[model samples]
Target: MSMDVRDLGGRPVIIGAGIAGLMTALQLAPEPVLLLSRSPLGADASSMWAQGGLAASLGDDDDPALHLSDTLAAGDGLCDAQAARRIVYAAPAAIEYLARFGVRFDRTPAGALRLGLEAAHTRRRIVHARGDGSGREVMRALIAAVGSTPTIAVIEGFEARRLAMEDGRIAGVLASGPTGPAFLATARVVLATGGIGGLFHDSTNPLGSCGQGLALAAHAGAVLADLEFIQFHPTALDGPGRPMPLISEAVRGEGAVIVDETGRRFLDGVRGAELAPRDIVARAVWKHLADGHRVFLNVRERPGPEFARQFPTIASACKKAGIDPVRDLMPIRPAQHYHMGGVAVDGSGRTSVTGLWACGEVASTGLHGANRLASNSLTEAVVCARWVAESIAGTPAHRTKPAIASDRPSPDPTTVRPLLSRALGVLRDGEALKAAARALLPPAERKDAASDPAAVGLMIAIAALRRRESRGAHYRTDFPHHAAVARRSEITLEAALAAARELAPVLEGVT
Candidate 1:
């Protein structure tokens, strides 16, 4: 296929179509933006799969301080206080912003926003829409708004392959589409490419979300923070599904209980019980599953018949699996649900790399710390999009010359899933991590489709190996306790390669 290069006259290019990407483009408003999406509008984006609502301190009894308190406690000491405070405080405004963009949130009979509760939240502050279809509603409105806005150019069916760098800054995006390779020459770029759950066999993220943004940034000399802190949702509807259906924590907050096959409510003893922080619940569930038992979510008495009315999406999934939530026990297990780490960004969503910014799950803004509070991911994305847009709008887009990029095969995580699932799941240890790193080194250095996914997996393995203490989602069986002092971990591709090389001296090929 022939390569096509087009200059957008220094328009800031947003390389995603999720909430972060859509919100940034909308906020940039009359300013032109080249919005790219690998799949049709909301078809394969993780944002469209989000069931839990966006977190905002919208209730009368709830306050941003209270929200921040819950956030910090869930973060387990790794969240940057300033970022978490700013984002949570701005959460209410974000909800309003979404509403202004045509998102009609669930409202009370008194014409106020109806708030729901989630795990680790002290008060009911989750603002949902269309019941459990919050993400779908948000995406639908944003996609419609984007279509009507003439300034934003929507480009679907194209995937960003690489960031074309000129003098150590972004000059253009090398992307591949159905026709051929196309390079959009623009000085500024925003990455909102979602999460890395696809790297695990049992994950809740779309399979297309295999850390493409992380790989793109890492290759362009960007730093990624806390790569090992992967949040596994404890109650994913378990079956033979590749990307498991998330039995949202909202269901649990609504009174559903978790139990093992013997009809024992296993989490009864833990503080907050099924409502504990996700990492804790996931670990408990994982250990139970490892101990020759089957775990299930029992909504029989809690939501009962209202389960279908309150959470129709989940109810449909249950029906498909031949399990009635009002009668049968819904089989469940822990699955990789979210990533609390990605291209390390500051308060303004600016990465270490100039002319580049990240948002959504692909950017570690330090708000999530070690574990994400339920429903905080969407809140963070909506809250950070404004800041990202402001930073981009304020900066002048530098002129860039036409650029050329080699055609690279699309990334495939098929070879990476099992390796990551084994080494970096809910439980980890030094030996498994080291072995994963060594095993991933060869493919990471290769030029095949598995390279990018392997490279992301390798970095995660290295990060998991380096963190000696157990903190939040990153639980190392060998180091099952927190360090005396809490700290966040950061990594670059170079550092990860160096660590991998040390593990496999004379790595199979490229040293």
Candidate 2:
């Protein structure tokens, strides 16, 4: 069914109402904009659930250069140095902007912003709000600010299923809302649809985050970079839940330790132990669990009884899981937390596809190379969102009659979650990746927009299989060491599908 796109007007349309989308809308204010959220604002967003604070060089002793250095080191040789530098230099001002939006950050006795430490950082520069509720607080402030802005129109409970293209530029978005399927016409579209963690059985992201943006962009012929590099957080609270609760790295910064069932410290041999880069720490914990040793994050003694006061959110989560951080060791395991890969974008958040932009976890801006620096995801979202908005502001609007695209039902995530979890979770091998790629290929071939999760799953598996060496978060057991030279993988969805077809026979008899 085709609908006229002219009804939706020429206002810029933003998708996914998380930090990135909200920030973009606010930045473009005074210039009319339309914002879309799959769920209610502040709900089901990884931003609100994020416990760690934003990373910025706000301290006198810290500098942007130092922050850039840490980010580069964490990226494991694949980071774009210029992008890292740009984001770090913009950090302090970004924090100030958030403050203007009414975000109350933790402060010191002297009235300066209080900074906390995280892994791989040379200085204490993590700015939080209410200890572990930084993301929630930021979202609360942004959501309130968005409500008062007269130029932004928000539509909640709508899922963007496809991007409508005309003459090779984005023209409109085909979405399914409470009123049923509808198409919104716009000259520009911004995709801030979070990460691909929902494809994993155990993840710290909301189930709705199934890489819809990546799939949409791929179907629109956008180039994707480094899709295999997924960061598995080391300390998600062990439990049976769709979205597992995370024990923020801030707890470790506050003096926690990871121990085995016998209370033996398993990370003692690694330099920096619990404070090591997340990739290193997660891999260590995964090895321990794979070796039949149960792991736990013990903060009962180091941080002591004040644990509840320091991290109220994590404390609450622990209590709900029937454990007290002040007295008991909390069971922990590695779970998929963030993606370092997505539709390739530049400094201004422009994707390879014309008239489309992406920010937050949905865009690979080269800040996070093979792995993301702690607390840097939020920083990238705000910085790139502002740039994207500014870039759009200077452009003239064009009104085109909307052309309708096929509206396919979104695929059930359950069909691909288990396969992805087994093949692309914390640890991976070539055979499993090949099988996953094979299993996911059919959906991509069908051109089913509903199979977005399967499309992204195939991309991740194919990227992981191609990168034969271990680097950062992507560890291939078959290729247990880093490559002699570091390089990144970039491919279009069409090319990936072609490669998948060629490899099908080779993987048929395996397993």
- TM-score list, all predictions: 0.98, 0.96
The clash number for model 1 is 0
Model 1 CA deviation exceeding 4 Å by range: 1-5, 505-511
The digit string of per-residue lDDT tens for model 1 on 37-138 reads 898889989999899999999888989999999999999999999999999999999898889989989998989998899999999999999999999999
lDDT (Cα) of model 1: 0.92
Off by over 4 Å in 2: 1-6, 404-406, 447-450, 506-511
> How does residue 118 of candidate 1 score in lDDT?
92
Evaluated against the true structure, the overall lDDT of model 2 is: 0.89
lDDT of 2 at 169: 90
Q: How far is candidate 2 from the true structure (C-alpha RMSD, Å)?
A: 2.7
